[model samples]
Target: MKFEILQFPLAKSAYGGIILPMEEENKSEIFQSPTQYESRLSRPKNQFAPKKIFIILFSIVIVGLIIFGTTRFFAGGKSEQNSEPAPTAEAFPTDIPEPTEEISPTQEPKKPTPTKIPTPKPTVNPVDKTTGLDRSNLSIHVLNGSGAGRASKKASDFLESLGYNVIQIGNAENFNYEKTTIQIKSAKEEFLSLLKKDLSSNYSLGTTSADLASDSRPDTIVIVGKE
Candidate 1:
C-alpha cells in the first residue's frame, strides 16, 4: 500500500527531534539522518547573547545618566552664580553743628543837634537921599484942604508913624482941593517917590510940585484933599 505525503511541514518533539507521521517514520526518503539530527542538536547554545544585549542596554542607560547628572550640576552652578546678591553702598555719619547764642546790639551812632538861626531887626531910621538926613530928622507939615475935620491931624499922625518928624497940622487956604498934593523944595524932589509910596495907601495923589519957594520951613508939605 502507498501512503500520501502531508501538505504541512513537520513539527518538533519535546526532545527537539522532528515529529514525523508514523507512516514516514521508517521511510528513508523522508526522514533525516541520525547524524544530521545530531549535528543540528549538537550545535553550541549562544550563552552570552542575552548577557551581551543586557550589558549594551545597561551601558547606554549608564551613559545617559552620567550626561544628565553633569548637565544638572553645571546648570545648578550657573543658576547659583546668577542668583547671588549685588553689593550695596555703605553709610557714613554726618557732622551736625551746635546751636549758638545771639548777641544784643550796642554803641549806636548819636544824632547831631540842629543849630539856631538869628532873626534880623528892621531899620527904622533909613537916610533920605535929598535932605542928606535920616527920615526921622526931616520936618514935614500936613494941611487939610478937604473940609473934613481933623484930616490934617490924621495925615500928620500917619506920617509920624513912618519915622517922619511932623512939625505942624492945619487947614489950607481953600477947601476945594480934589486930590492930595505933595509940595517940596526942588532940592528935596528925590524924596517925592518915597513919600508917594507911603501916602498912596490912604490918599489918592494929584499934582505934585517940587518947585517950593525955597524959604519954606518944613522939608515937605502934604495937602490933604476930598478924594
Candidate 2:
C-alpha cells in the first residue's frame, strides 16, 4: 500500500509575509501576457513637473503696482481738491455798476496780510570731532523717538524746553550715531558724512559706555557742543 498522506491544506491568501501571492501559479485561469502586464505597469504621467515661480512672482508684482497706483491716484485727487480755493459770494460782481466805493487815505483795500513764515531753525552740531551741522553731517541713523511710558515725553520735551533745537529725531536704539568711515552712497561722496568728517576732524568724540545711554526720548535727539 502507498504511504499515508502527510501533506496539509494550501494557504487561502498571503497578506504581508516573505512569500508573495501565488495566485497566478495556483489559479486555474491563464496568466496575463508579459506585454499586457508591462502596459498596465506603465503610468501615462512619467516626467517631473516644473514650478511656475516666475509667472507667480510676475503676477504678484503686477497686483502690487496696481494697488499702489490706485492708492496714489486717490491720494493725489484728495490733495488737489484741498489746493483749490472755493469761490466766495463777494467774488460775484453786480449787474449794474454801483457808485465806486470811495477809499479814504486812512482806509485802503484790505490786502491779505502775509503770514509770517517761520525761519528754518538751525541744526545743532554734534560735539563729536565734526565742525558744523550741514547736509554733510554723517548721522548713521535718525530716531523718531519719544520716551516710552511715563517717561516717554520727558526726554524730548526736556531737550526742547532747554532751548535745544533737534534737527532730526532718531529711532530708539543704542547704536553708533556717527556714520561709518566707509562710503555708502557714491554720489554723496563729496557731501554729508564726508563734510562732517572734514569739519569735525578737529573735535574728539568721547568714548561710549553702558552708562552713556541716550538721555533723549522718542522723536527727540540732543546735540550739544563738545566738552
Candidate 3:
C-alpha cells in the first residue's frame, strides 16, 4: 500500500506549508476539547428540556384543576342535602269573651167584667068577662064564722083594699058550722065562682032560701063558718 501526503497553505504571506496525510487530516477534524465537547452536547439537551418541563407542568396544572372541580361539585351537593326548612310557630288567642245575663218578659194582669142583674116583674090579678063584675066592681060582705077576735073587721078591710064594695060585716048565726056557705039570690053563677077565689078553701055555694026575706037578702050572701 502506498501512502500519500497532502499540503495545505497556512497563510498567503507565509510560503511554508505543512503536509498531512488524509487520515491525519480527518483525525484532527474529528477530535475536540473537553469543555467544547461538553458545551456542544448539553446545548441540544437544554433546548428540548425546556419543552419537556413545560409539558409536565402543564399536565400537573390540568390534573389539579380537574380534582378541585370534582371536590367542589360534591361539596355543593352535600351542602344542598343538609339544608332544611325551619318550623313555624303557632299563634295563641289574646282576649277572652265575657258572659251575658238573661232577662224574663213582663206581663200585665187582666180585670174582671161586671155582671148584669135582672129586674123583677109586676104581678097581675085575674079578671072575669062573662059577668060584668071584676075585682074593681064586685060587691062583697065579710063574715066571721070563727070565734077569732076581729075576724069580720079584718076581712072587711082586706076586701076593701082589693077594690071591693063591702056592704056588711058580722058574725055567722051558728058557730058550729065547719064550712062557709055562699047564698046567691041572683042566677049569676059566674059571679059566685069568681068570688070563691078570694074566700077560704072550706067555702061552698047554695041557693037563697025563702026564709031570707027579700029586702034583707043581698045578691050574694057570705055566711062565715069554722074550718
In model 1, residue pairs whose N, Cα or C atoms come closer than 3 Å (at least 3 residues apart or on different chains), thus clashing, are none
TM-scores of all candidate predictions against the true structure: 0.42, 0.21, 0.35
Per-residue lDDT over 1-227 for candidate 1, one digit per residue giving the tens place of the 0 to 100 score? 99998686687755688775566556654466777878888899866688889999999999999999999999999999999998998889988889886555775556798887776545466565555556775678899999999999999878877788899999999999999999988887777888887899999999998888789999888999998
Question: Model 3: runs farther than 4 Å from truth?
Answer: 1-132, 201-214
Q: Candidate 1 at residue 130, lDDT? A: 57
Writing each residue's lDDT as its tens digit, candidate 3 over 1-227 gives 99899766433212344444346566555455566768887884335667899999999999999999999999999898789666789899788768765444664444687787876534334354555466655455667776678767876666555556678888876565556666654543556666766664434433333233345535556665555
How many pairs of residues collide in model 3? 0
User: How many Å off is the CA of 57 in candidate 2?
Assistant: 3.2
Superposed Cα deviation of residue 13, candidate 1 (Å): 99
Model 3: how large is the Cα RMSD against the reference?
32.1
How would you order the candidates by TM-score, starting with the best? Answer: 1, 3, 2
TM-score, candidate 2, is 0.21
Q: For each candidate, C-alpha RMSD in Å? A: 22.9, 44.0, 32.1
- Judging by TM-score against the true structure, name the best candidate: 1
lDDT of 3 at 117: 83
